[model samples]
Target chain A: MKDDYKDKLDSLPVDIKLRAADRLKIHLMRQKYGYFSRLCLLMALIGPGILVMIADNDAGGVMTYAQTGSIFGIGFFIPFMIVMLPVAYIVQEMTVRLGAVTHRGHAEMIWKRYGKFWGAFSLIDLIIANVLTLITEFIGITIGMRVFGVPPLISSISAVLIIASIQLFLRYFAWEWISLSIAAFNLVFVPLVFFVPHLHWGAVARSFGTWHIKGGVSSLFIYVVLANLGTTIAPWMLFFQQSSVVDKGLTVKDIRDGQFDTFIGSVFMVIVAIAIILITAGTVYGLTQTPNLDIQTILSAISSKMGPLAMRLFALGLVEAGLIAAIAISASTSWAMGEAFGWPKSINMPPIEGWKFYLPGVISLLIAGGIVLIPNAPLGFLNLTVQVVATIFMPAAMMFLLLLLNDKEIMGEHINKHWQNISAFTIVGFLIIMNFMYGLTVVFPHILG
Target chain B: MIKYIDIIGFNGKRCDMKNNKKTSKDINLDEDWEDFIKEEGLIDYNKIPVQKAEIKGWVQIAFWFLRIYILVMIIMVIIGFSRIK
Candidate 1:
C-alpha cells in the first residue's frame, strides 16, 4: 500500500525475509525458553493440542475430581488418571494429523469423506453439547463467585462480558495466550493439598501400587468414574483440536510439535486432577470417612480446613478454568458448525467475514450466562444432561476420528500402526465400559450412581 | 490383537509439500511460506501424500472390529448392571 515500503520490500531478497522470519521466531523462542534450548520446538508448535487438552479439564472437570476425592478419596482415581494421560493423548493425536494433513476440521472431513447425514448429526450434536458445556462452565463460575460474596447476577453478566471481550478483540495467538494464562490458575488446587493436615503419603503411594476403590464399586463410585471419563474425553475435544489445527494453518510438518504440545497439556491435566483429588481426599474423606459425598461437601471441607481465603482461591480457580474452557469450547462449536455447513471459519477472520463462525459461540455464552442468572435453574439436571449427551456422542465421534486417521486416502501413510491401534482401541473400549457403567449408575444407584 | 496395525507406526520428519500430489489449492495458506513449516516429531508428515497403493483394508476392518467390540463390552456392562439390580 505504501510506495516507499513496497520498493524496500521488493529490494529485500526473498531468502533474506524468510531468514528474518525464522530468526525472529528463534529469538522469540529464546526469550521464552532461554538460550541454546531445543525444547523450544514445542513452544513454537504449542497451540491447538495444549488448548484442547487443558480445556478438556474445564471447571466442571475440577469439580468432578474434587467431588470424587471428597466422596471416595484418591484410592483409585489418581493412578487411573495417570493411565488416562495416554488415553487422552492418543485420542487427541489423531486430530493433530487430521488437521495438519487434511487442512480441514473434523466436521468438514466428515461431510466430505463420510456423508451429509453423519455430518449434519455431528454439527448439531457439537453445537448442543458445547452450549450445555458452556452452561456448566457458568454454573461453576456462579457457584465459585458465591464464595467471594458476589451476587450471581453480576458475576454471570460480568463473566459473559469478559469472555465476549476477549473473543471480540484478540487475534488467535493473543487470545490463546490469555486463555492459557487463565488455565494456569488451575494449579491452585495443587497447593491446597499441602495445606491439608497430616496427609498420608502412604495412602497416596498405595493408590498407585494398588489402585483400590475404598467401598468396592458402589453406584456413586461408578457415577463418579463415568463423570470423570466424560469430562476427560468429551466430544468437544475432537471438534476443538481438529478445528484449531486447521485454523492455526498447521501443515503436516507441525504434527510432531503439535503432539508434544498435547503431551504437555495431558500431563498438566493429570497433575491438576490429582491435586484436586489429593486436596479433597486428604481433608474431607480422610476426616469424615464419608461415602457418597458431593461437590458441596468438598467445597465445605476446603472452607473448613484451609480457611475462607483458600476456599475463595479454589472457587476463583474454578471460575477461571470454566471461563477459559467455555471460550475454547464455544469457539469449537462455531467452527464445527461452520465447517459442517461450508461457512467461512477462522478466529483470524473478521467477524463480518465469518459471522456464522462467530454466531454459535456468542449465542452459547449468552444463553448459558443467562441460564446462570435464571433464579436457580435446575443446574444439577443440566450437568447430568451434559454427561449423558457426551457419553452418547463420544463413541460416534471417536469412531469417525479413528476411521479417518486410519484411512490411507486421507492420512496417506500416517495411518495408525499396530501398537497405536491397540492403545487407542483399548481406550475406546474402556471409555465405552465407563459410559455404560455410569448410565447404569444413574439408573440404579443402589446397584452401580 | 486388533490393535496391532502398522498403518500409523512409521514416524515422519519434513517432506516437500509444494510437490505433494494430494496437496490442494483450496487451502488459503501463506503462499510464500508453503515450504517453511516444520514438524519436529509427527511421523505422518514424513510420508507426505498417502500412497493409494498403501491402502490397508485389513487395518480398517480391524479398527471396525474394535469399535463393535467396545459396543459389545458396553452391552455386557448394561446387562450385568441390570441383572444385579
Candidate 2:
C-alpha cells in the first residue's frame, strides 16, 4: 500500500506534489497525535495572521501611537485602541477564510472573479501603496538606527541586506519564524512604559470611563482619530495576509487556528500600541509639553524624561517595527504581483527557480532604500504621498473585501452572518466618512472651522 | 499517451510539444487536472456573483466615491509636493 501511494505521488506534477507532500506531513502528524496535534497544527498555521497584525504596528504606526499619546495625553486613545482590537480582528479574520476557502490570494480573487478594470485598479493601488509604505519603513529604520549612532548609509544598506537576505534565502516557515523573533522586540515599548516616573495607574483606568474627547470634537481630534483608524487597517494588510495564508497552504479546516492567530496578534498590537501611548502620555504629555511631536521630537523627549535605557529600548522597538513591516510588505508585494500576473509564486521556491517572482519585491525594496539614502530626498512629501495614496485606495479595498466575504458561492457555509456584515459595514462606513473628512481638511484647510 | 498527459496539464495557453515527440515516460503522469480543480473548488470562482443587480447599487456608489477620492488625493499630493519644494 505504501509503495502504491508512492507510485501515485510520483505521477503527479511538481507543483501539486509539493502541495501534497506538505498536506501529507500535516495529515500524518495529526494521525499520530490525537488531541495534542492541535498545538502542532496551530504552530504550522500561525504565521499569516500574527505577522499581519504585528506588521500593522509598523514604524509609521508606532509614530502615530506615540503622537496620539503626546498630543492628546492618552485620555481618549487608550480606550479607543481597546475598541480597535475587535474591529481589527473582525476585518482580518475574514481574509483568513477567503484565503483558505479560495486557495487564491486576495489580488487573484479580485482579478479572476471581478474583471480586468477593478482588478487592475486594486493591483495598482496595492503596489503603489506598498512601495510608498516601504519607503516609510526604510525611513523609520534609518532614523531609529541614527538614534543609536549608526549613519544613514550604513543603516540603509544594512537594512536592505538584512531584509533581502530574509526574503531571498529563507522558505516560508523559516521566514515566518525569523520575522516573529524580530517582531517580539516590539514589546520593548511595553516595558519602557514602566520607566516613566510616577505614572498613575488610576489615571489610565479613569480614561476609559471619561471616554470623552479631550478638547471637544475639534478638527485635530478628528484627524488623530482618522489616523488611528487608518493605521489599524490598510490596503496592504488584506493582500498581505490573504496571500500569506495561501502561500502557507492553509485550508478550510485551518480557519479556527488562523482566527486564533489573528486574535492573539491583535491583542499584542493593541497592547504595544497602548504601551507607547502610556509612555508618551505619562512622560511627554504629562510634562504639559506639546510642541511639534513628530517621532524625532517624541524620541528626544523620551530620552530626556525616561533616560537613555528607555530611549534605547524605544529605538529598538522602532527598528523592529520597521524591519518586520518591511519584510512582510516586501513579501506581500511579490505575492500580489505573482498572483496578478500568473507567475509561479511561493517562498518555497528557491531564488534560482523563482527569480521572476522575487524580482519585483527586491527591486522595489532597493529603490526605497536608495531613496532613503539620498540626502534631503523630500521625505516629507514622500510621507504625504504614502498617506494620501493609502487614504484614496482604502474605500475601494474595503469594498472588495466586503464583496468577497459575502459571495455565497465562494464562501458557502462560511459566508458572513448578518451581524458580521453589519459590523463590517459599520467599520466601512466609519472609514469612508473619516476619509472624506480627512480629504476635505487637506483640500480646504478651514473646513475644520 | 502524450495526448493524455498534455490534456491533464493543459492550461489555457497552447501546449508546445513540437520539439519533443511523445515518449512513454510522459505517460507516467496521472491524476486528471479536472479532479484537482474540482477538489480545490477552482470552478466556483466563475460562479461568484460580481454583477448581481442587488449588489451593483452599493458597488457602483463605492466606485464613484473612490473615483472622486482618488482625484482629490492626487491634487493634494501635487500641492503637498510643491509646498515642500
Candidate 3:
C-alpha cells in the first residue's frame, strides 16, 4: 500500500507534490508545539486591525480626499498627514490593549466595566454611527458604479450582495484575507498621484515649507479641515477596532502584533489619504471651488485633464475603499452589538452560534443599499452630518479612552507614560477646543479669524 | 516553502513598516515598560484588589457616558442639521 501510494504521488505534478509536502510539514510542525509553531496560529489570526484602518478611509473618506486634492492641491496636509500617522496609531493602540485585557467590545467594556447608562449610550451611539457610516459606503459604491454607466439601483444591489456574501459565507481566516485583498487596492491613489500632468514637486514641497492654506481660516476651510479629521478618526473606528481585537482573539500576548498591525494600517491610511489630497491639490485646487465636487465631478475633471484611463482607475479606488469599509463597518456593528448583549460574536463561528451578531450587519447593509434608491436622499447633507456628529462625539470617546489607558489596574504594564499621557491629553484638549471653536464659529464666524 | 515573509506581509510602500520584523516589535508601546512595571501595583486607590466583576459604579458610569454621548450627538446633529438648509 505504501509503495502504491508512492507510485501515485510520484506520478503527480511536481508543483502539486511540493505543495502537498509543504502543507504536511506545516501540519506536522504545528502538531509539535512550541513558539516556532505559532507562525501557523499567527497566519490564522490576522485580519481585524487592517480592516479597521482601511475602513477608516471609507467611501466618504475617499470623496473627502478627492475633494481635498481638487481644492487644496497637497501642500501642508501632506505633512499634516505625517502627524496623522501617530494620531491614528496613538488612538487605535488603546483599543488593542483594551480588547486584549478586557476581552470585550468598546460598547460592552463601557457598559459592563463602567455601568448601564454609559453602556446603553455607547451602544446607541455605535449603532447609529455604524448605520450612518454604512450609508456613506453605499453612496460611494453607487456613485463609483455610475461612472461605469451602471445605474444606482444595479450598483447598490450588487454592492449589498457582495458585502453580504463575504460576511455570511466565510469563516474568520478566509474572511480576513479576502477583505485585506480589497484593502490593498486603496493604495491606488498613491500611484494615481504620479499620473497627474506637469505635477509640481517643487510647489508641493514649497507648500510644506509655507504651510499655506489657499486662504486663511474661513467657515468653509474649517469645515473642510474638520470634515477631514472626522473621516480620519470616526466613532466607528473605536467600536470597529476593539470589537475586531476581541473577535480576532488577540490576548495580551497578541496585543504586540495587533498594535503592529494597526500601526501599519494607520501608515497606509495616512499615505493614501495624502495621495488623494496631493493628486487633487495638485490638479483640482485653485482650478475650481465647488461644494458639489462629488466623485463624478472630480473624476470628470481628472479625466478631462489627465485621461479616461486615469479617471477609471480613480473610480476603481473609490469602489474598493467603499466596499472594504462597508465590510468592516457592518462587521463592527454586528460584533459590538453581539459583545454588548453577551451574544455569540465571531466571523469564525457558524451562524448557528452567532446569528444575532451576523444578522444586524446584513440587514443594515440592505437598508443602506436600499437608501441609494430613494429619490434625492440628500447625500451631501447626510455626509456632512456624519462628519459634524462624529467630531462632536470625539471628546467623550477620547475621555473614556484616556481614563481606561490610564487605569493601572486594567492596563498593567501598558499604562500611558508621561509623554503618551501628554500627547493624549494634548490631543483631547485640542479636539475639545476644536469642537468648541467649531460650535462658536458656527455661532459667530468673525470672532476667531 | 519557508516563505513566512510572503505569507504575512504588506505592500512595500516606504512608509509601510508593517512586516519589518525588528521595528514591528517596538510599535504601540504607550509607556515606559520598566517604570510601569515598578509603579502600577495590582490595587486601586482605596487599596482594594481590582477585580473585573467588581468594577466600581463611578468608573462604570464614566465609561457608559462615553458611549451614550455618541448616540445623543447623532440625534442632536440630525435634528440640528434638519433645522438648517
Best by DockQ: 2
Residue-level lDDT for A405 in candidate 2: 89
lDDT of 1 at A244: 81
Q: Considering just chain B, what TM-score does every model have?
A: 0.34, 0.40, 0.30
Clashing pairs in 2: none
Instruction: Classify candidate 1 by CAPRI docking class.
Output: incorrect
lDDT of each residue in B11-78, candidate 2, tens digit only: 21121222223322333224443443344332323234344223377766866776776777678766
Off by over 4 Å in 3: A1-45, A446-449, B1-83
lDDT of 2 by residue, A1-449 (tens): 33444555456553344444454444433333234444655676687888899999999898888888887885889899999999999999999999998888888888877777778999998999898899989988988999899998999899989998889877666688999999888888887877788789898899999986767766677778988898899899999999888877777877898999999999999999999989988777745434236787778888888898888889888889999999999999999998888887777666876798899899989999999888878877777778777887877887888888888878889999899999999998888788777666666767767
Q: Give the local distance difference test score of model 3.
A: 0.70
Q: What share of the true interface contacts does candidate 1 keep?
A: 0.00
- Candidate of highest TM-score: 2
Residue range A83-176, candidate 1, lDDT tens digits: 8798889989888888878877888887666667667877777877888889989888888888888988998999889887777665565577
Q: List the global CA lDDT of all models.
A: 0.71, 0.78, 0.70
The C-alpha TM-scores of every prediction are 0.80, 0.87, 0.80
Per-residue lDDT for A271-323 in model 3, tens only?
A: 89988887776567776787558566788778887888888888888889889
